[model samples]
Target: MANARVDRLRMMLAREGLDAVVLSHPHDVRYATGYHSILERWTQMEPFAAAIVFADPARPAILVIPEANLGIVAVLNRDGPHCTFDEIRSFDMLNFCEVSRYVDPDRNGGQLAEDAMAIAGAIRGTCQPDIAAAITAALADHGMAGKRIGFDEHRVSAAVAPKVPHDYRDALDFMMRVRVVKTGEEIERYRAVGRMADRVIAHAGSLLHEGADWNGVQAGICDFMVRNGVIPVDEGAMLFGGSYDGDDFIPDLFRTPGKRALRRGDIVILETQGVLDGFWIDINRTAVIGRPSADYQRLHDILRDAFLMMVDRLRPGVSTNSLPAIGYEHLKAKGVPAPEKLLVVAHGIGLMPLEIPLAYPAAGLAGVKQGFVMEEDMLISLDSLFFGAKLGPCHMENVYAITAGAPEPMYAAPLELIVADHAPADRASEPA
Candidate 1:
């Protein structure tokens, strides 16, 4: 699996015109080498460490990983070269001579240990003061006094002393420039996750009722994701009732479901999660208790059409900004609201649920010249949501790959509203 990923990384290196690239970021490291923690003790102390990738157009790929992670590296590359291993205990500048062979292939011996020292210093300060002290000595021994290297500005702290010069790029950009686009195997795994989410959501929808509480719904969906092969231990799903009705309600950043039972005329927004190989697919669907009003139905129709129209615009050469514009025109032509003002277009989705190359627009985002260029293999989400003042919440969601032609929806669950028939026994006096 990682052999293919390494090949893609080499291609990226060639495109970027970089001689060799080092990956100390956990996500980047995983993308390149598929090395996860077998050394739980050291991982807890320094969970964010990774190996450097030195790509030479002429030679084979070389990776520098921790000695404890050798097993993972071995499994990741059963058919490829055993990646070079560096012991974490002696990770300072003094012991970096071994890495020089991989880093500076032309040099006979001498340590260009600036990056290792900087990485050691950064991880040392996290929770383990003892490790911090040890890595401080490593930097001094390595002679990484002055060198230009790229680091994640978003992650690297202000307190850490700068041992080397750094290039500032948004951490999202650095990662997505390499990862936003998926490989054939990655897309297959992603499709599997989406199918799992679709089945789980469908099962949850079938078991719904007017008396069902938020916990009941969440329990069913959670079990389904786990049974159908999704990483079950994430933050899980959020069930919104009538409490968060306004535009100010940011949906579920950190809110859990309440004791509110399903009632007649209530719209239930189900945002279930699916994970395959650490990549994520978030698909949200709205289920209505009893049939909805004509006005609510109208909004759902408009949003559905708009969602398809926006997704149809994705291709290899189109701009990310064009998505929101097309969605706006789509809704406007149908006599609905604008996409930007309504916030109902597509967005980026990947390992973190939301990646960069966002499909939406913002002020000063025009001419930013960033985001998905609709390149082949880029995985993104096309989600259209409607928050009605007269009704409740509605969402149509799917994952898409930017191909040479049209965008492909990874998950193909029903796009329209799923209506449930039941009367609210406790709210007989309430008006619809």
Candidate 2:
């Protein structure tokens, strides 16, 4: 299959007048070359892989990786359509195999010999002493020497500037602009991960009991996600429940989960985040232990209705800056106390949790204005949170794919407050 993501990067580079882009960010490399380095999980300061994309459509993108990963890249290309690099180059890092010795065809005939030959071919004339030298050589070979090249990371740009003769510029904002829209494959991966996270959050609701604590719920969520082929992001899951500081009830959403046990009628907010392939899954749901009070129910109903209204308004050409106003007006009309406290944020979500058009504000980010219009095939998460001092807190977050007609919810979870009852009599005796 053709890689549409690389094509998009090339188009963006051409439009911006950049000759080529050298990307060292782990997520940027994966999005460009479809290669995920194991070293990315260990360190971010030292990049073990890089991707070089030229503005010219004819010049194929190159993937510069460590020599240790050549075997896995060969295997992935042989077994499936995982790796999407047009050319593979390597640099000497931690070597995994002895390059001097050849695999005996007689002893390892079928797959081993084939893989060995592929690895040898990949590293034959492309391996360099280090990442800077490897990228410099690739740029020179591709006629990009002394050209206007964009670097995604500032540190990588500074390190490579001394070695390569090129006009380097920062391209972090350029990269975000290219990644705002999702391709067909990326959308499919998002949907798949969204379905998995929905199931995981539902499992979390089942674990709610009188004695259930945040740590236990988080542990269960992690175990469940690992068993189901999704990698948990960060703390696996975040569990926040309502509590009373003194005579007044303080609804704090930012409190870290501890050993405090969950009690009946306490509102709980559960957010599940995971990754499948290269896409991220972030969805949140709120539930109450046993029955909810009338005040809590009314508050949740108003929030849910407001959430639905905003989601329905998501379509092509709708300004994202206007979404918060729409939500605020609806909440105020419904007599929601402190409607200004309701935060409505809409932003793209794919390779990362927060992508451009950033929901929150920053000092200097070009092309990331607040009133940007939503486009088709843009995967976004609409997050709404309201913390009331008396009624506790309520949050509703969901991922949606902007389409031609109506926005499609990536998961099958309902947008109502979950009323989690006590554990069954038979299962209550078992350990959590």
Candidate 3:
């Protein structure tokens, strides 16, 4: 998998004329190196650091971590991208030595000049003072001193800018221009994770009955994810009955399932997290214990319709901004009170809960704009959320992939409202 990804990355580098890329972010590193962490502890400090694809295959050299990381490096370099040991030293000069071999003048300087101009890109979580100096010094030594380099402006730290040797621009356009679209292999991996998450959500739903409390259900969901190997990146699980006026919106005292039995007409909302291979897929559902009230049913129907409309309209060349507004316009056309201060939509799913191209009106970043264009292979969530002060809030969210034609919904659950007609036959006792 790493080699396949590297093959694409190498092609990207050749196209861009880059000598090599110095990656410091764990996600990008994992994608490029396929080397999961080797450190026994989860400290911020990364002891086992390395770089890959310096120039060409013959010139390839990957820095090895210490002895403790030997086994991990062997596994990661199984496809053979040239592994070189970085003996620990006060200056950590070995890191510079291995990197320099591909760029700097060897005592064999004359021959090195031909490859000297090869482009070098550096990636870091944030540019800190020390990291900046190290990168700057490394580049200056390599003779690619004044060339144009790239950095993700939004994601790169301000402190790290002054240390690089050349001009750097926001590389988000460059990186996403490369990473966002899913390959066939990536799609299958995402699907496997998505299905695993679905099962966890369903299992969690089975445990939420009449007397469940906010914390109890939340805890159950957390356990469900852990036991099933899905890690939740976010903790906000909004659970409220018909319009508690957003009172349920705030952090409140945790409650346990007690004598407060959920009656037949009560609205129950279930939101779940799904993670597989460190990637995320979210699924949310709203239900009624028995038959729902007329208003609730109608409102749910509208929200569900809005969700489907958004799904139908999702495709390449469409703007995310249009989705929520269209849904709002539809609701307004139907005489539904469109509250100005509600969260109508959002785009958050991937390795992190939120990646980019958000869909909220208040989300005023240029990255969220329509001209930005939704492209093929991009994964996003199409959501329609309605808050009713009189009936609690209702939400419909689905994960989909932008394809050649339309956005394909990844989840296979029924889109309509889900009604739990009967609790277990042991109705006398509440679910724990």
Off by over 4 Å in 1: 38-45, 58-66, 69-149, 153-172, 232-235, 239-254, 333-341, 357-371, 422-432
Per-residue accuracy of model 1 over 176-282 as CA lDDT, tens digit each: 66777788877887887777767766766765677766566666666666665566434444333233333232234344654466666767776676565667757
Model 3: residues >4 Å from true position, as ranges? 7-19, 38-67, 73-147, 151-173, 234-266, 339-342, 346-348, 357-371, 424-432
Score every model by TM-score: 0.69, 0.90, 0.69
Ranking by TM-score: 2, 1, 3
- Give lDDT per model, in order: 0.55, 0.76, 0.53
Per-residue lDDT of candidate 2, residues 1-432 (tens digit): 368999888888889999999999988888988888567889757788999888887877788887767666766677677877767677877554345345565674567557746655644246687887788778777777679999987776676667577888888878877888888888887878887877877887777776676567777877877778777775635534344454332345654545477777767787777777777778888888889999889999999988889999889999777778777898799888888888777878888877765433432342233656899999878888886556778898999999998999997898888887767442222222
lDDT of model 1 at position 17: 49
Candidate 2 at 129: error in angstroms?
A: 1.0
Model 2 off-target regions past 4 Å?
A: 94-113, 119-124, 239-252, 358-371, 424-432
Give the candidate number with the greatest lDDT: 2
Candidate 2 has its poorest 10 consecutive residues by lDDT at 359-368
